[model samples]
Target chain A: MTVPTGQCCAPIAREPLAEDTAAELAVMLKAVADPVRLRLLSMIGSHAGGEACVCDLTDAFDLTAPTISHHLKVLRTAGLIDGERRGTWVYYRIIPEAVNKLGALFAPLTEPSPGPVPQPVAGRSELGLLPA
Target chain B: MTVPTGQCCAPIAREPLAEDTAAELAVMLKAVADPVRLRLLSMIGSHAGGEACVCDLTDAFDLTAPTISHHLKVLRTAGLIDGERRGTWVYYRIIPEAVNKLGALFAPLTEPSPGPVPQPVAGRSELGLLPA
Candidate 1:
């Protein structure tokens, strides 16, 4: 049996899902199934240099810093995002492999179009993008 | 103001999300954020004729009818799918617009590739597909 590993996930509609894979994906989906976390993930994934400082994320919402931290914590725990503390501020970036699993699930259903039309991102020198 | 509607959604990482949009998407995500529901959604979407009969679905799982019914109800309520009654059976098919919204959220982060590699689907003549 070929165990497909690190390939995000097989599309949701592709075949009968293995019980283990479904549970794993459910946990990840639960992580972003909130208004705050969804917005936070969007903000980070779309941010300049493909990463954002936690200090900046807190400023966007009316919630307390601790509240925002809690949401980020959930996302991090689910493996959707990863954080790094650099000096005074911590930075976060999307784990492409994690997010890609979600895409493979539902994207195949849509008719083909441009991959994803990217919004203009200002390349910032401050948040040094970590090497791949 | 050109409010984008019926266009699925602007990609999550493309820009900061509007609050209302994020909330709506969260509700839908919450529906499939379950282990059973995710598997259920996959089974239906990948099924022949792009839909599945409720009676046929229950046979695949170990749970009782009511348990499966409850999960189906959640998926239906969230607008991820639509159902129609035909004689003794109720058939369900994905609501493309809703599922597409999820794709828009996460698909963009992955590198451009073939839209979705479709799995081999055996066309069943029995599941009379309802007209679009």
Candidate 2:
């Protein structure tokens, strides 16, 4: 399979992302934006040996097999996970680089504020940074 | 405004997130899943003084003011950004804690993998970690 590119992009907080780059990121983020998909990703990432089979994942959800399969497919299409069949079962694992790219995207926003905190600008309120 | 809760949840890679926790995360992620919203976020995050007024943001896009306003509203609703009116303009800035929560969600996935690589299990393919 072809490896995904764009791993080297700067964090969003460091600079404004180009439009095309933002589009690509939005696609990936959209894929993992569902509760089921996020849980599936978590399960796959934290599973023993860093992988889990489709059968194992289905039991954890109240949804049907096809629904779970659909979520996994979305993750794979987004390049966030991969699946390979072995006999009658398919095992999935997190794509570390993709996950890392996401982490890097937000790293600047999350990193502790550096240098002195700038006073709120002359015409802006100081209410923007409060925890959501 | 009431501060949003759930800032202290563990990263998704550290363990399987609770159902409700995953739901909340999904809501926030879904809000950021659009291309325009992502670019707007990047612009707000990287702007000088780490904040930008609505008037400034609208110029960066090839979109109408209303369209840009809609996108910014989405970001604000997601808790990723905050906007407050000062005079005739509303300035927006990243919500450090919310962005940090997102970064932390994937931190474990991105952190250098720990320990020796495990042998591929008997029934699974070893192709899952390839970048992408």
Instruction: For candidate 2, write residues B1-132 as lDDT tens digits.
Output: 333755756666656777877888898899888888888888888889989999988887889999998888888888889988999988999988888888788764334245435554664443222121
Contacts from the true interface found in each model, as a fraction, amount to 0.66, 0.60
- The C-alpha TM-scores of every prediction are 0.78, 0.79
Runs in model 2 lying further than 4 Å from the true structure: A1-6, A109-132, B1-6, B109-132
Worst 10 residues of 1 chain A by lDDT: A117-126
lDDT of 1 by residue, A1-132 (tens): 112554545567556577778888899999989998998988776665566788777877889999999999999999988998877678788776677667767765444333342222323223334343
Candidate 1 segments whose C-alpha is farther than 4 A from its true place: A1-6, A110-132, B1-5, B109-132
Candidate maximizing TM-score: 2
lDDT of 2 at B94: 90
Error of 2 at B51 (Å): 1.1
RMSD of each: 13.3, 11.1
lDDT of 2 at A54: 89
Worst 10 residues of 2 chain A by lDDT: A121-130
lDDT of 2 at A114: 52
